[model samples]
Target: MAGTIQQIAELAGVSRGTVDRALNNRGRINPEVAKKIEQIADEIGYVPKHRKKADDTVKQAGRGKRIGVVTQLSQSSFMLQVNKGIRDASKKLADQGIEVLVKENASVDEAEQMQAITELEEEGIDALAVMPVDCDNVRVKLNELTEEKNIPVVTFNSDIVGTKRYCFVGLNNWQSGQTAAGLMGLMMRGKGKVLVITGYFSNSAGSRRVDGFVEELKKNFPEMDLVGVQSSFDHTDEVEKIIVNAMSAFPDLEGIFVASGGQAGVKKAFDKLDLHKRPYVIIYDLTPKNEKALLEGTVDFLIDQEGYDQGYRALSILSDMLRRGRTPEKEYMYTEINIKTKYNLN
Candidate 1:
């Protein structure tokens, strides 16, 4: 026997009205309670007629809506491309009566991100797109905004796991890490010392990349020595000391995989070493500094996880969701990961 809305409401300790509102995704109900009711419905296999009607209601009322995009946008050229993507999307959607408000933080600060989201919520944004930092507090805040405020969120660049974000727009970071490991192994002939420089450990993307790279090396290139891993926080100035220390400790270091920013500083450190055989350097992104390094033979390869597509598509997806109550067919829309070398610099 198929369960009714009454059954769902009773199981969730809510009223029939609440169950109807939640399952249909209509009306202003507590997001937690709504989530509970929906879960109960799914468990009991209860379907609502209002599902079709809700979409129509949203489509009719959703035009001329405003959206907010919050990101940890720094002065880095990579972030600049992402911002350009957002602006491009905004321009494309202007005729459709959709408005995008982009807000950026200068650094990867979770507190600042939370505050930005809070301000956007207060502004009554129809939806939100965020470059989330993987933190418990940020996830909680995101949940609160989604369930409590009924604003759908899509994460770009970085992700906050175990939350209700509609979807993630980025690369297959783990696979990308494995890709880098493969390149490192080939460049160093599967032997010699390697140093890994990572961004914020709290960033899900960076952590996943590191995990994949390390796991790949452990499985395939057991002979390769992983000399050390240092956190640079993706800042250029902070990376010099870490790189200098590694070079001092492992004078025979044959390669480096910078999983974040600060590649420019790493180059400076190499200049100081002046080794007859420079280490095989592999880094991420197509930033200007990285481009110069690749051309000059300072970096062997670059793993480019397209930033522009992430920013552009995140907003597009969020806008569709806001206007038509449409959910993405897939949970993660992964961008392409291109391996750029000097030969392909053109």
Candidate 2:
């Protein structure tokens, strides 16, 4: 710690009045006295914390943001929901002069995410909000962005450790998935073979949802056998392939779970196979497509996690951190999880 005013005054061989005025820039002190004090402090390597007024002035200068948002991919409804959240959050800060420039990777892979993040940096944004593709590389990238250019970052929807980031805002995925599984187990009376498909195991959110779903099944309804799990990348064609294949392999598959995107595809496969008659279906993300499926009874239950709201919450936290120096201490935020059935889908 730096010496107090008394010590500084004694060391500089000046009175405490001279030391105080010089340090505070009160302009009453002579130039010689101020120079001497500053020289002594520099020689001693003394740097002090900023006072409250000084801190507030600096933070107020950071209020209006020039922001860039990096997303996983643009194909899925889940990403669409998160984008909506960003828009709503930026709009709320519009009168305050904040601006958001959004960009997306074509896929959830290290190369794509790196490309998107790098492009966002080239845009010269003051701060960033991103859904990183890989936890390991993403953390390193974030550290580089912040340390090199002094740009702060916040992660939304997925988490990466070992670097500085502003915040993470997304669904409580495990709990949400567990809730989905529980709903499925209850609807089936805990005595059926269930098949669960996700976007991919590499993606953190999809993996967590699977873990939560399986954990919930184990804890809540062990009798319901979770037959097998597969990956879809949440695409219509890819998801169609998996769901159709799984339906054939698990002929007695009584219940279904789509833990990631591609809910509409799952419903479509079910319709084409005429399998909807037997297997009770539960998929995620209540977008317009899935909402329509819910209305028609093609999808039995839809766990609607509002992606847009997560974006809003994340941006709000990042803005507050940069502008007000307050970080969200809480781990997660609550998103809308609407369990919609055919009758109530409307």
Candidate 3:
């Protein structure tokens, strides 16, 4: 026999009313609790008699509503997880008759993002989710979209200020930077030279992270000298070149902090140098490459920004707004700043 709602409620340890709300998507319930109830329902093969009908109604109501998404640095390794989240959410939204149009840019170019936004606007997008370039033009465009056109916007991964974005979904980059500094300080034992490598100066995410790391290093680890700070533009070759040059300039460098992509270059630099003792290195993202490096003892730490959640929740929030007039519970939906080491790799 198919499991009943009562059985599901009992299994989930929730009231029947709460189960009904979660399964039917009718009322406000904690997202975690709703997820738990849904998981239990799936496990028990419990299907509500009206579920198909309710889904069909949602699909019909979602028809003709479109959400536009724009992402920067699509080629970066970290973006793989983020893009996966976007694609997953897009499929779910598509099942409900909502369209998610995505435009991926290869670089953090403000003009390119503005052009993409213009194209999506021409396509009659009802809402927008973007990884905006931190520039005056992009900020102005976002403001226009939210205020003049009345199109709700959600910024993910990277954000811009001075705009009426519905909410932001990503890491607290500054705090992550501070975390990196603290880890490096521990590894370096308080006094040594450290090098900093960043993706791009114009990117707010990278810039803020660098700022936080520098501030924390100055505050908590004043004895440690910052040997060099360089931008790699998220290119492996550039990162390798920067590392090689910095190593040449400061052979006694005791630590390194990478606030953005192109971490593969760090390994390349080590291999090329064939140093008997490598510097204590901390990089961002838990991508396969970074994971491998951690396992192989190349990187000391990895700070993951929950890339998948950043992509998924940004679209999900917009979908709720378009479908059910739901507003985000918080103005800033920061993802967890997870620290990954070899021992805890899972």
Best by TM-score: 3
| Candidate 3 ranges with C-alpha deviation above 4 Å | 1-62
Q: How many residue pairs clash in each candidate?
A: 0, 4, 0
Pairs that collide in candidate 1 are: none
lDDT of 1 at 113: 84
Candidate 2 or 1, higher TM-score: 1
Question: TM-score per candidate, in order?
Answer: 0.81, 0.76, 0.88
Tens digits of per-residue lDDT, candidate 1, 88-182, equal: 66764453456788778877788888889888878778888998878888999889878987888899888878899988999889999999999
Tens digits of per-residue lDDT for model 3, 86-173: 8877765665557899999999998999999999999999999999999999999999999999899999988788899999899998
lDDT of 2 by residue, 127-226 (tens): 8888877557777889998788888887778766677775566777888888888888888998889988888676877888899999989988989998
Provide the global lDDT of candidate 3 against the true structure: 0.88
Cα lDDT, all candidates: 0.81, 0.73, 0.88
In model 2, residue pairs whose N, Cα or C atoms come closer than 3 Å (at least 3 residues apart or on different chains), thus clashing, are 81-307, 81-308, 82-307, 85-308
Q: Tell me, what's the RMSD of every candidate?
A: 13.1, 15.2, 3.5
Q: With candidate 2 superimposed using the best TM-score fit, by how many Å does residue 202's alpha carbon deviate from the native?
A: 2.2
Candidate rank order under TM-score: 3, 1, 2
Which regions of candidate 1 deviate over 4 angstroms?
1-63
